[model samples]
Target: MTTTTTARPRHDAPAQRARRGSTARRETWGSAALLLLPAVALLLVLRIIPTFAALSEAVPLGSERSPWSNFAYIFSDPSFWNAVRVTLIFSIIVNPLQIALALALAVLLTKRIPAVGLWRTLILLPIAVPQAVSAIIWLVLLRPDGPLNGIATSLGLPTVPWLTDPTWALASIIIVCSWVGVGYWMTFLVTGIKEIPLSLYEASALDGAGSWRQFWSITLPGLRRPLLFVLVADTVSNFLVFAPVRILTRGGPQGGTDLLMYNISERAYTLGDTQAASAATLVLVLIVVAVVTVQFRLLPGRED
Candidate 1:
């Protein structure tokens, strides 16, 4: 009698639920696509299209020399090699210097310090000024007769040739790049640091961990993703450095500051060798991709 009283199942319930879920998923995907359309379109137009155009221009066509001639020419040129060397050296020095300074400032500013906002504003102020304007300003500052040398003279210190001597010219470019980049990188680190839970620090203190120990264990691990991002972005930015080199050095006191981008621009604009410039562009892109790939592999926390 009890078994006989058992009602038949509502067979359509599960199907109805499935239909509802499918509809919801479709709506969610549609919304996401709508949200992403503008950015995707912009990237396609600005970046993807131009990169393909450059690639087409890079390859030699009918009635031209060998398909690899442009690349061969650049590879054979001493100036191109010098630009590569200078770019590598600049990257080796500037990336670490900027990240270290930015991390230090991030840590210091995130502490309970008075007038921290004012300090941050002052640091970030340089980013608001255009890089070209910044180059012009530093052009004046680094000149032999400018205020920097005037101060050095007042202090009885040797007046340095910041932008004229080859070694000093590269160093001056590094300085300018770092001054602009450090604050920008610091903002990212500061945001990362704030996202770290206060409970972790408190727990570490309770466990008798010193400031340095806490930083090593907690802060650095928290910063892995942010640091990786900064590393890649900073590397790319440094590689594409052209304005400062063009404005300040014009590829050098002995080609010392001729970064790859400046070299490419010089080939295209100055010498009217668009083919060589396009080939160099491909090389620059490849180098950036390789460097960034290595950075991603080395840094932990990809899951984040």
Candidate 2:
């Protein structure tokens, strides 16, 4: 009887303490969710809603009102396919080339070259200039009577139609795009390179590895994650390229530089065909998704 009485004396104490702890955790989480709601709501309204709306417009149902006809229209048009091809070609050429050049430049900058800070600044200067402005500047530079042609003429070479000629129009677009983008992309590579542990390089040197060998054996392997990140980011950015095309080429010299984004913009704004534009956007999104999915799948241990 005495033992039972003693044990019953403090039964409410444990329950009370547990209730207080639970209440404290609930308040903490409630405050955190309240703080996060605004950002979550903004993203939903701006990004998620518009994406779904665009998808809806792309899908033509029946009586030509369905998304099927819209998709059919996009797929059936030879011009659309041409634009797609051009876009893919542009992305494939520019992204890899820029990445290679950027990596090279970043490595050079990292090597304590003379006036290194100055050189880095000069390389990044183009990024500070607006893309539209850069395109316009290059438009003048590449013109028949401009600096490039002048230089060629001084060297006893024939003047070339850099922008107007169909043969050179796409190439010019790619060059201009790379010029504007390479510096920006280089910054990312530089950051990734700087993050590598110095000990790895020292160890590689101790193993009698030359600079090139060290880069291949240690640097490249260390950069796998950053390289993947940059690759995906650059791919997406290159796929959406429109500024240079819009300002300098306008998808011209017989649409040689017509990218998918330019086509969508033309349909939506110039042609006032929102539905068609939305369909084009949906198609572009699908292509991007497919590319990214394939990339991640091929990457080791990336599934998680």
Q: For each candidate, what TM-score against the reference?
A: 0.90, 0.84
Which pairs of residues clash in candidate 2, taking residues 3 or more apart in a chain or in different chains?
Answer: 59-67, 60-66, 60-67, 60-68, 61-66, 61-67
Query: For residues 136-243, what per-residue lDDT tens digits would candidate 2 score against the true structure?
Result: 999899887999999999999999889898658888988887887787888887888889999999988888999999889877877777778778888898899888
Task: For candidate 2, give the lDDT of residue 35.
Answer: 88
Q: Cα lDDT of model 1 overall?
A: 0.90
Query: Model 2, residue 284: what's the lDDT?
Result: 95
Output the lDDT of residue 294, model 2: 79
Residue 42, candidate 2: how far off, in angstroms?
3.8
Backbone clash pairs for candidate 1 read: none
Which model scores highest in TM-score? Answer: 1
Best by lDDT: 1
| Tens digits of per-residue lDDT for model 1, 1-304 | 1123235446658877687668767777887898899999999999999988888888867845888898999999999999989999999999999999999999999999899989988997888999999999999999999999999999999999998899999999999988888999999999999999999999999999999998899999988888888888888888899888989999889999999999999899989999999999999899889998888889855784
lDDT of 1 at 55: 87
Q: lDDT of each structure?
A: 0.90, 0.84
